[model samples]
Target: MAETITIEPITRIEGHGKITIILDDDGQVSDARFHVTQFRGFEKLCEGRPYYEMPAITERICGICPVSHALASGKACDAILGVHPPEAASLLRRLLNCGEFIQSHALSFFYLSSPDLFLGMDADPAKRNITGIIEAYPEMARDGIRLRKIGQQIIEMISGKRIHASWVVPGGVNAPLDAGHRQTMLQMIPEALEIIIRTLALFKKTLDQHREEIRTFANFPTYFMGMVDEEGNLEHVSGRLRIIDAKGHIVADAIDPADYREYIAEAVEPWSYLKFPYYKPLGFPAGIYRVGPAARLNVCNGCGTALADQEWAEFREIERGPLMSSFFNHYARLIEILFCIETMQGLLAEPAILAARVRAVAQPNFPEGVGCVEAPRGTLIHHYRVDEDGLMTWANLIVATGHNTMAMSRGVLQVAKRFITGAKITEGALNRVEALIRAFDPCLSCSTHALGQAPFTIRFMKTDGTILGET
Candidate 1:
């Protein structure tokens, strides 16, 4: 008789997380937990640093979404400096943001989540990884890898290195965009566009095959949130916030990012270190909403890129304008990739992109500042209070992954009940649990929570019918 089930260090994901299902005396799933086993003390380490260094320092939060951190921190630094970045700098910042969205989203769908989608969820546990994906579809594998490389290449070409910290700083970019680099990047745009379009097309075909699965897979409704442009176009940076209900009614619109704290509040969950962020109007558990690709796609009007705009419309048609399924989050990631390539192409045509004046000189002037930008994973916010001489006094970061904590727990419980039963635990049952977590494409490594293996076994006290311990 099987007593416990554990999924340790789930594969093809960035960080460490585990889920255990304990069976009871009657062989029922007695308890379920999705625990994040890591810690990152960025708040403590950030103290005492000058505000000007925040952009680079905070960018280290997540290698996957560093651009989001850089942008948020840079914006906070801009607020601290009390100067608006030049139009050219704003354009470059948006361009870099597109690169981040493309790479991070690609990593989420193509690398982490696709394994279960492409190979059946019940596919051999050992072969159900990227390696399994490579053997099954070599070109698709190459596409995801090469496509991610293009995004990193853009970041490197612009910032002087991959994951280059400090390229963004108070008031403006530390390194200006060079004419030659833009030209080089411009040359690659056509190829990049083709790659994105083709990959998206292929993904659509896969989605078509899995339409039933996509619809019913994880169809639970969620309150959607994201920063949208003033005109309601999907905003990755510098826009008013919008929150919409599952049925597509605009619950809140044109909300400024600065007033974010007022509209959103964090809630603690006993099972996970990650905090759940929800809309204030609805209150705690009931207000539990979702952020990231699923939330962004649901609330945004369009991607603002020509080709991606067309694909975005088609995506909307599939869901009759807004998709809420956590599964389609994969589709949303691809759509954004299409948008990023298109956005990058549009930026290249602008003379300012190739212009010399990317940075404006300025000095920090504020005692407190807040920075926010949509990371590929979700909306990332960084707030800091600085002393007159610019010594950091406090740090508060609301990571994209943290925003999904509520939804993730819900997803875990939902999946556990669906696949886990009185029968003995199997690798497939365990994969379903991990697969549910991957659906969020969570970035726990980048979030406040750290990443480490804590292999655990959950056993039941069958005779007394008491839940025992984490062994």
Candidate 2:
């Protein structure tokens, strides 16, 4: 008889999800699925709200990346008002994003993924957590904690709160960067850079031990996407979109984010609430592509910083072409943290960072608008249609994790087939399946916004396990 194995509430991730593995009669793995089980209708929730309220409203979607949501929403609102924020405001916004990337990446790498790296994957479940890491590797653990604190402190200094700060607004931020805050942030940069540099060196030493994992965990060809500056360097806060194929060839360059629909489209699956977005030219499942740290590294020409540029050059040597394994996302994330810290240091030293003018106030001048940014996880896009009175009529958000749905689903199957050879699977084998998803570091809460009507069914069962009916 065929059997199904389910791992509920996939551990160590930001939101709720599960994995299901089906086995053949011979006990061989047949298929697998990664299911996102929660749904928050953020798009529909903002329909009747005023367009200016979007930045505040959408930031509520996820506490982990509220700054990302706010920035994307603010940019869309900027377009609706038909005004541009001052150059100083743009610089400040980029600085805020730097804080977000450092903290978020720290959480993903140190607290969540490091346990498996430091401890063996087959280690006791009771001991495979941050507590275990503290007991065994205290110094690394301390570095992780300090890195996240530094990131949050940077956010609070600029926006007055660590999470979901309202400092970001439609045309610009609510206040300019204070001189005291600038000096304080600049003082913290050296320590931030030191921690990431040391951590990256430590991480590189462990790569050889996980070679099997590196090869089996979603190691396949696909397209990559991210935002890039004019010279095609890595960009997060603002830039044109760039996409490259698995062979490191640029299939599209300098795409206007406002016209995202021209090159991208969304599809839905009945099993999961998350929508699958793909390159429109290829259509549906055939258009599968990836985003986030590895994708960003693969898509961009360079990091545009001293240390990071050196690291990026060495990172590319992992393969003849773009790194294909999702496992490399962990390595890519460390390099990005290094990039963010170095970038912040330069931005803070600028004389014009403290300019008094930070905002531009205006009413709605356009009926439709779009905003896009490279969120810590991947590319984030917010689109809006407003009425003459400045009230929102429709809104669509394509979150970072949503863009990787198809690849994640395929990855689940790949990892399952490689590890599970019989009906009685080992705990470590199960952990490998979950570990694959962690490599993507998905934020299910932010990605589960459904478009149109999502598929839903309810079933009643008898005590004997017979289903009554499902609708």
Candidate 3:
């Protein structure tokens, strides 16, 4: 008889999810699905709240990317109030984003995925974790911890708190970058730059050994989307949207993020709470595309910083067109950290960053607003509709992980088919499947924000694979 294999509470990811693989009577894999098992309706929850409170309220979506949420929410609130933050505020916001990228990416690549890369994928489950990494590669593990700390330190220095900071507000941040904090942040950059350089070298050295993994881990063609500056350099804050085809051709360029509905649409699946977003013109699954580190590199013309630009060129050389495999996200993340460090150093060196006029006082001047930013994971968008009194009537958030849902689901099937040939499966094969999802570094808690009642069901089953009851 055919059977179903389920990997519940998929490990090494930010939130809860599971993978179900279906087998044919001959024990051949037939289908697979990735199910995001938890849901927190931040959009719905924000209804009726004051629009100005959005920066703090919506940021509760995920602890890992709270800075991203706060920034996006702040931008939308900026629009609602019809005011622009001072130049110093803009610079500080971007600087904060750099810190967020470093910390979040370090956590993804080191604490979560590094074990599989260092310790074998088939290593005992208990040992295939951060503790094992610490035991085996003490120096490298310390580097990861230190790098993440520097990032959080930058945040604390700028906003008074690292996570869920209320400093980011409607018109601008609550305070300006002081001279003391500026010097401290600048001092930290050198160490950050050093760590990233060595880590990049170490990772490159090991690439040859993971050839089989590189070949199978979500290595498929799909459109890519990300934010880019006017010169088409990789941008994390305040830029227009760019979508490139798998062949590295620009299908859409300089799209006003406010017009996202014109180019993007969301669809629902019965088995998962996460909504699948795709390029609108192509429609549904056919419009499937990817976002985040790999996609960001694929869409940008260059990194705009010296060291990262050189690495970016070398990375692109992997394919004449855009790199398709999500596995490269790991490599792309390291490059981004290099870019962030360099970018932060430049921003802190600017004298105007210490200006005290950081905020613009304003009342609600618009009833609708939208904001966009490149979160550590990918592009994050926040849209809001408000009453004349400034109370939120409705809101929607398109998180980075949500944008990649289709590709991830399809990737699970591809990996499952490649490794599961019979009823019996190896532990390594199962891990490779989970590792495929890890490549995207999904924050499931931030993605599953359905507006209304989402499709859900409960089923009780026997140990022998028989369904006993349903709800």
Off by over 4 Å in 1: 1-3, 208-217, 269-274, 449-471
Candidate 1 vs candidate 3: the TM-score winner is 3
Give per-residue CA lDDT, model 2, range 231-285, as digits (tens): 9999998899998888999999999999999889986656544366888887655
lDDT score at residue 64, model 2, on the 0-100 scale: 85
All models: lDDT?
0.75, 0.87, 0.88
Give candidate 1's error at residue 91 in angstroms: 1.1
| Collision pairs in model 2 | none
Candidate 3 lDDT, 261-361, residue by residue in tens: 99999876666443668899987557878999999999999999999999999999988999988989999999999999999999998888999999999
lDDT of 1 by residue, 93-163 (tens): 98888878777877787788778888877789788888888999898788888888888888988887778
Candidate 3: residue 228 Cα off by (Å) = 0.3
State every prediction's TM-score relative to the real structure.
Answer: 0.91, 0.95, 0.95
RMSD of 3: 5.2
